[model samples]
Target: MLISDSQKKILSLLADGEFHSGAELAEVLGVSRSAVWKQLNGLESLGVPHAAVSGKGYRLSRPIELLDGAKILDHLDEQHRAKISSLEIHDQIDSTNTYLSSLARQNAPSGSVCLAERQTAGKGRRGRQWISPYGSNILLSILWRFQHGPAAISALSLAIGVAVIRALRRLGIDKAGLKWPNDIYSEGKKLGGILIEVAGENEGPCYAVTGLGLNLFLPEEEAGAIDQPWTDLGRIAGGRPIGRNQLAGELIDQLLKVLTGFEQTGLAAYLDEWREYDCLCGESASVFIGAQQFDGTLEGIDAQGFLLMRDADDRLRAFASGEVSFRRAFP
Candidate 1:
């Protein structure tokens, strides 16, 4: 069974460095002492550490450092506060996007966030496997129901990329950049990727699930499994492992802020910001489009979110979504 509301309340009360006697807590919460004890036991079963002092009643061994949904909600500006309906955290899951999609199918409210500490079967664009080890990365998804058609949702991933870069910059890593479509990078190594999945018609109301997978403290062994060059926040932050909970909160905050604007303006409004941080701009690169590949100088993305590249013939072409890959040119 899931933890009860009273148990969650007890956990919240003990989140800080305060202790409450059984009688005191019961009186404050309008419950019986026995009820409080039962809830405490439930928390223990859920792996939350606590000390039962004879006189002091209960005290957490360490402050609970999980992301506080209430705190995040309180921090949001008035415009975004109304859209958020719920924030759910899980210790482990197959995929946050998949989990949230189930709720979306049931008509779950927009701005619902689903986060997991670990994802055993995380996925990326084109069904690529997303590496998600336990307690080492942030795996989360946000549900945004849109009134726009599916065509307008093409730039959703780009918008999310902008949000991620902004959030990382706010966390003091100002060098973060965006790779077209979805990847985030710093100094050429990948920091994260975004995957946007739509669950509606092309011309009807659509539900977009924006998923993010960010590396925080990737294990050496786990990192080796990645075929491409990758990086984590620990290295970028000067060897300090960033707090996952703190990063998660910042990510949600930035995503919510950007998403609110995206709902109104589509992707055209964020083109300038996205271009400013695009790492591939002015670099010679190649993009694979199915059986053919185009090698050219990376110009930048247009207002419509298509990649603008100047081919060898000095002709510019716009490339839409596909199995496109990026590589640096050697002199």
Candidate 2:
């Protein structure tokens, strides 16, 4: 899934959703018409859609707001920009999380961010394959080094969820909510998810790679692969497109704020804020653990970020992690 420099150049030219004649593209890219044709033929593998008309030349089905590292940095405020150690953008990668995880092994500094336009092997929580089309959505990961161990950051993902909701709100998407441990929802449909991977000691220094996958504009082919109901930010925003650079800047800013706050005050500082967007706060939830199952009424999350539920026997139960689903119980 490697996108050559020539292909990237051609994509940038076609990104406006307007037709470009083969001769015109060839001249602009300083390549032969055959070379441009070859690159155009390879766009399908990258999940980019285009139309080739006899007289009108080639036109993309939709215009894309591609990521620009410079624009992202420019959008950040001085304080937030100072916190970021490094930010890298890729045309294609296996996974942003995987890339940052490897860097963490080399003592990668905190506040490093990685973004990818296309992920051939993108991953989600619980071993689900993340569907990412080139120039279609947000696929990013941030690396952070913590003085405390992995156990101390148990509430990290929950805090990250809050950051995501806040970032969406900044873009006028105020209806987004958090679904328990790690998913973002809009109008009861899945919008995005968070995946955190930690490496290092249990009681000392640790590194975490926090990954986020958000749907922006999913085509029919990609949407068909998802097993659950899903919604994209574009549709929720009345089909108005938001630039990827602006969205990325907002996410990094909010994420850094929450991470710094968590580093200082633990999860207690975010409990009340998280409750405001808690999607399953009062819904009946069922958890499946191997051959066992437990059903209870959601009482919101505890201060430690664990899910709190009132069981059938009137006892409160807290779960660290499991496969959970919400259901309505008949009165």
Candidate 3:
């Protein structure tokens, strides 16, 4: 659901985690007190939790860092800045990937980016919903046109993972690791994920919408909605406040380099770098495909980005895609 401009304004005011009276919000926004009350109430539908006391007024459940387009653009290196055609910031959207994919079909220029403050229908790999709360995470997508077909860019997700880890490390969060095809983990808990969608023909030119979601902070109410173990930058940073705009800028800069170089080098250029952040390498894990499951020892990724698994019989097998569960080494 799209939010009103007033709602967006109120959110920005409340982002610092300070309480504000309805009268104060109205005075600041040039709206009536009743209008401010209604807007605050509407935020609940958008998954934003807040507290309203008899005397203290309203405040968000937690402090948040909202993305700023100007800050992100200002942080980009000259070369990276040149690669972008346009950058859009939205208060609410169904999904950044969905928005970009549609634009790609309409011949949107390469290097176009879309960032949303909240995603009502964010997506995850294998058809799972990507839970995102207002102003609490990085929800972004970049559309890049490639000369090669889908097959040529199959390992793109793996390469994107490398970029994400590089960005994290740049910010001093060194514990994050790559989880095979498309996840970022810290101490076995998910910190973020990527979802890539391709468009165009089979033989020649194609376009990719690389979507990313990184958690900055997860409120208690939002945490309960996730099924798997998860950790945000807040926990990773040991309660230190992270700058959402700065992080978003770093992600865009690193990913632009990855996407631009990927066409010429494929995943080969990133293999060694990716290995450094391998999360499941040298571990025991289970792979799930459909209703079938196989237990194997994780042996890291192959040159082509396929997962290499050593089974009980000491035979090596490669898989291109599967749901993986890391566990204790098999006996």
Candidate 4:
């Protein structure tokens, strides 16, 4: 659901995590006290928790760092700023990737980007749901047109994983690593994921909408929907302050750098870094493609970013696409 002006105003005020009286909130929003109460009551729908003290009125359950375009751009290198043709931030949207893909169809420039605080219809690989509590994670997508089409960037998603880990390391969160084909793992739990959608002629010009959903602070309420082990920076930072804006900025910078060089070099430019951060290079895992499952020991990724698994029969097999689950968590 798109946020209304009044809702934005109230949220901005309450974002300080300080209680404000109902009268003060109502006066600031030019609405009645009853209206303020209704809006506060509505926060739960957005997955935003709040506390309503008997005398203190209301405040968010915890402090939050809302996405700010200026703060994010301040983290971008000046030389790379020009590379971003269009940029936007939405208070709410169905999906950043879906929105950016629409712009790509309209001939949007190569560096167009779209981000949202919440995704009502976020997507994930193999038709799964990617969920994020409002303003609690990074939901972003970038559109880049490739001259050589799909094959040119066969390992693009893997390259994106490298970029993500690089950003995390820069922010002093060095343990985050990559799970082949696309998930981000740290200490055996998922921290985020990458999903790339490319379209156009197989051999001609095409465009890709590279989407990233990262958990900075996945509230317990939001975590209930997830079926597997997952984590967030709130846990990884280990009491160190987690800065949302800083990480988003670093991701944009690293992604642009990777994209700027990828067409000329493909995954070759990122292979070394990707390997350095590989989380399942030699792990036991299960690969599921439809009803069939293959039990194997992972042997890392190939040059094109495909999964290389040693089947139970001891024969090495490369899989282009499938869902993989580690036989056991590894730290």
Give all TM-scores, in the order shown: 0.77, 0.96, 0.95, 0.97
The residue-by-residue lDDT of candidate 1 on 226-279, one tens digit each, is 877888887889875455666887888889877777778888778899999998
Q: After superposition, which runs of candidate 4 have C-alpha atoms over 4 Å from their true positions? A: none
Error of 4 at 81 (Å): 1.2
Report the CA-based lDDT of candidate 3 relative to the real structure. Answer: 0.90
Q: Which digits, one per residue and each the tens of the lDDT, describe model 3 over residues 1-331?
A: 6788898889889988999998889998999989998998898888787899879889998777778889998868999999999999988899999999988888899999999988888999888888877887899999999997999999999999999998888889998999988999988889999999997789899999999999887777777878888889988899876688999999999999999989999999999998999988988899998998988899999999999999999999899999999885322
Task: Compose the digit string of candidate 4's lDDT tens values, residues 1-331.
Answer: 5667887788889888999999999999999999998887777788888999998799999877888988989889997777999889998998999999898899999999888899999998777799898888999999998899898888899888998888888899987999988999988999999999999999999999999999998987788988888999889999688778888899999888888888998888788888889988888999999999988899888877778999878999999999998977465
In candidate 3, how many clashes are counted?
Answer: 0
* Highest lDDT against the true fold, candidate: 3
Please provide, for model 2 over 241-310, each residue's C-alpha lDDT reduced to its tens digit, 9 standing for 90 to 100.
7888899899988888877667778888878889999987888889776767889999988888888889
> Candidate 3: which pairs clash?
none
Best prediction by TM-score = 4
- lDDT for model 4: 0.88
Clashing pairs in 2: none
RMSD of each candidate relative to the true structure: 6.9, 2.0, 2.1, 1.3
Evaluate residue 241 in candidate 1 and report its C-alpha lDDT on the 0 to 100 scale.
47
Error of 4 at 18 (Å): 1.4
The C-alpha lDDT values of all candidates are: 0.79, 0.88, 0.90, 0.88
